[model samples]
Target: MTSDPTSDPTPGSTPDPTPDAVPPTETVRPDWAGIDRLPTLDLLRLMNAEDRTVPAAVAGELPRIAAVVDAVAARMARGGRLVYAGAGTAGRLGVLDAAECPPTFGTDPALVVGLIAGGRTAVTAAVEGAEDRTDLAEADVAALALTPADTLVGVSASGRTPYPLAAIHAARTAGALTVGLACNRGSALVAAAELGIEVEVGPEVLAGSTRLKAGTAQKLVLNLLSTAVMVHLGRTYGNLMVDLRATNTKLRERARRIVAEATGADRDAVGRALGATDGRTKDAILVLLADVDAPTAAQLLKASDGRLRDALERARHQGPPPA
Candidate 1:
């Protein structure tokens, strides 16, 4: 809980604990806290119930999440990047969200970057002296020459991680839009950003180990942030990933299926269209519907700036090509 600067910690009369970095130890415990004594089935049920709370907690923050997404989409539409910064579980979540964007929405990797305090090594294994150093976060953001147009999101379960907050502060200083995602209400991290998203998931199941509910909330929030941002950027067409890059056998097959699904065409027809456009779904769709080859389709896509609907319409209805 937060308090006024002049407020006392005691109910009636002491110093408030608002400045604390770690969550305080609680007096009350869950009835099933003593796990060693519980039956296996009972323990599993308790865990599942706790897991179910995560989604609800995330749902409560949708309004704030939507605001952040609109700001991010506006910046990206102007040609700026989106960057994620965090530590530990939050850091890994940031990295995972950024990594998945390339394959899922077909964005360039450079468009969305994730920076963890301990670098790539901290992703799998723990690294000491990482999150404590805000300077490192500051330096990383500084080196990127992050401009006023970019969007920087900092994730921290505790709401007090120095590294993440420092990144947020640096991004704001550089004139970029900043967002802070934390699991505590009225967190300092939240206060640091122009926009704050706090998902109150309560304390962790494991005492002092925030990797439980806090991590779950962070994961869910990150998923929403990235997915919503992608949708706003026009990466999806009619609920389908029409711009996906067919880089491998699996993705190639998935791309074909997506084309067939989105175009209401047969698998054979989809394959022929895909072949004509060299495996580009949007291009192939235009080629089939407009009876054009890859170059003409690509030119049409350029004319429409990657919005498949506009490209297809122009390809079918536009005046003769310019001399």
Candidate 2:
């Protein structure tokens, strides 16, 4: 980060946001001259070694990452959604993370969303310089009917991308919680977000090609952000993913193991309980613990606001007050 938080080393948010600020060359390399003669395997080895350093860059942002998790968790508890907005590779990564939330945490599809400039088609194909437009970012969020309770995360490696920064500013205007993630220090993208996480991984091995170390760093940070938020939302019981949606055969087996592990029950017993309760592990646990039927256990979960421990504690302390 720059010693002066107000100064943006990136473009768009700064008055002197010239092309020099976060120059494209910082992330890209001229591969045509040297790559024509080198062995493909040698080039692959160099890329792999560069990719290995991304985790350490992410590790440096743990404190900022925790702040994002806490804020996102609070917003979610209030019925606010988490929205990831970006352009280019950063935008696609946002989409990827949001797409995974449903099966991993049993969250409603709308609860976590992603918006990229140029829309869904842009995810797989370049949309002819879409990231340069600032207005598109604002328009996408407006279409979502954004609320103050929502949290918007903007991703950009250069920290100067017009689309992501514009969306962050717009999200803030709606009183939503905002987070900006970039790979450059004192980025305009960071300045726009209420909480900025800049993981400076330095220049890429391939000259200015950001898809190298910088892209890896952003992916790791995003993984931490979403995973931590899920943990805070009670999606897990101890180390077990009690709320995972078992869609495929492998996942069903994983779910059975989770229930058995949590309850100290055999696979047959676990399967029966889970089947009876519509494959809900938490509900099955409540039924097993309270010695009650499915509906009764479900009502307890509802009354306790879906907090498993609280529901079970209330069940245990019933029939009180002998005067």
Candidate 3:
């Protein structure tokens, strides 16, 4: 007898091919199915509404983020490096944040490293199958020569990307702290790392395109992580970026303003103090606030481990600078 094509061969077999599909939370929303048919204004409004939820989702993870930042700061104070590894949009964001560290916090370029699955070429265009290569991730971590002092952050929107998972494992094996940032909960990437940060931004408005809300969530988390770490490491003085490297005309002007604002010093004194310190903002601030020569300010800063507050306190305890 001929069998029906639609009939299941086994008694308990499912006819649907994709039985173990992605969870509904990660799958595309049925409400957004008609987005293409909506008017331009409505479409824009809908997308904007979806974007608004991202920040709250990020805010919910603040306690965890703080814990990671504190841990990273302690390690970094011991000369540890912050390394970010991922693929695709997540990778690009990591690279962008790493690149910005130098000018923003006067960090050495090598101090915060970003490694993408396909290297530099994958930043602009997708490389075929690069994200699936776990070996490449292992090799990249090995090249960094990670130690107990370093912290590695693996970013993946889906949380199942092989590249970052492997990188996390490799980093852990090398005695480094590992963190996983993903938009989905209970992901393999999160399970493998020492710390797991799942933002849970929900399904995308564009149906699985995570570069929208998920990407924004990642950016916000990264901003918090790096900025908080920098602040904890004494890179900032009273919300001012004292460690900024003034590499351009605008930054130089900003540096002078920062000195004036920080110490309540006159413009002329700011200029003179900055000149005395060779345009180093932190040293200039110390020179003005501590009432000491540039060299003395440098020594005090070194003694205080570059903490402006501690240096000021020590300088105050020593009384006024000798005439």
Candidate 4:
């Protein structure tokens, strides 16, 4: 039998025989018997077919995901932070999402946080019993000093994992918005959080290996949550990532293309606008489109709260900030 990836049960330990105790993600499918005996191509096909079902499972939870997105956006607008906490693959995914926000949305790294159960060490290697340690979860949360304006998302495929469940409780107690992203129905994590998102991806191709379908489901929901919230918070301008940080050569080129596309400016004009605005794509677009100087574009964007659309409308109303 395939062992649950989230936990390290004692060697030769028998699974609890209670039917209700077994989550669908852990239930072994009789049809998948002798999957190892199949040819390599057939094995690949089986896994591919299973992977295709993840999107639909995620779709089934869109309403819940939307609710969480709206709530997170509202909180973040009020100076709240978004925090993700989990263990193992779930924890790694949370950290990955949080790390991308700075480059993707030009957000402060501290604005979105990811906390794994075993801390930094667990990120690269397993830490025995870390998932079962509720104290670690509480301490990690305490360090955040979370307030009502904050949000903590507990990610756990099994739903019953102690780490994320503790995180949800801790966040809720602090009056922060609590969201549980889980793969099992009627899970403790879902029921405990103020907002619950359960994307039932069912059993994995390898039976109890939640890192397959369950991980995919969590990732899809997380992408939806973070991207939608960022959009609502004015991180994008008409589907363009105007606030992206051009920290690398590729991103710098992308910034130039963004400015040109947004303003229909020539390459030279785009380069000049970007130069004038200190390489800020949104400011460059405003400089080209609003017929304003770089400093005036900065002031306009500041007044409009970094929203390119709002700044443009204000620039039109004010008529290019005098001479």
Q: Whose TM-score is greatest here? A: 4
What is the descending TM-score order?
Answer: 4, 3, 1, 2
Task: At residue 203, give the lDDT of candidate 2.
Answer: 69
How displaced is residue 104 in candidate 4, in Å?
A: 0.6
Error of 2 at 15 (Å): 12
* Candidate 3 lDDT by residue in tens digits, 1-323: 11244665433221322335563235878878999999999999999998999999999899989989999999999999999999888999999999999899989999999999889999889976677777788889999999999999999987877788889999999999999999988877889999989998998888778789988999999999999999999889989999899989999999999999999999999999999999999999999988899989888888888888888998999743343
lDDT agreement with native, every candidate? 0.81, 0.81, 0.88, 0.89
Model 3 per-residue lDDT at 207: 76
lDDT of 2 by residue, 102-181 (tens): 88888899999999978999999988557866777888989888898899999988888778888998899898999999
Q: Write the per-residue lDDT of candidate 4 for residues 1-323, one digit (tens) a residue.
A: 33365566543232223335778888889999989999999999999999999999899899999999999999999999999999999998999899999999999999999999889998899987787777788889999999999999999998888889888988888899999999989988889999999999888889888889999988888899999999999999998999999989999999999998898989999999999988999999999998988999998888888889989999998654443
Q: Name the runs in model 1 displaced over 4 angstroms.
A: 1-32, 319-323
Q: Please provide the root mean square deviation of candidate 2 (C-alpha atoms, Å).
A: 5.5
Clashes of 3: 0
The residue pairs in collision within model 3 are: none
Selected candidate, larger lDDT, 2 vs 4: 4
Q: Please report how far candidate 1 places residue 8 from its true position, in Å.
A: 29
Output the lDDT of residue 18, model 2.
Answer: 59
Better of 1 and 3 by lDDT: 3
Model 1 C-alpha lDDT per residue in residues 1-323, reported as the tens digit of each score: 22354644333112233543445321125664797777989878876888898899899999999999899999998989999999888888898888989988889999999999888999999877677667778888998899989999999887777778889989999999999998888787899999999988775556656677788888888888888888777788888888788899998998988887877788898999899888888888777667777788888887777777887778668831442
Candidate 1's displacement at residue 172, Å, is 1.1
User: After superposition, which runs of candidate 3 have C-alpha atoms over 4 Å from their true positions?
Assistant: 1-20, 23-26, 319-323
Q: What TM-score fits each model? A: 0.89, 0.88, 0.91, 0.93
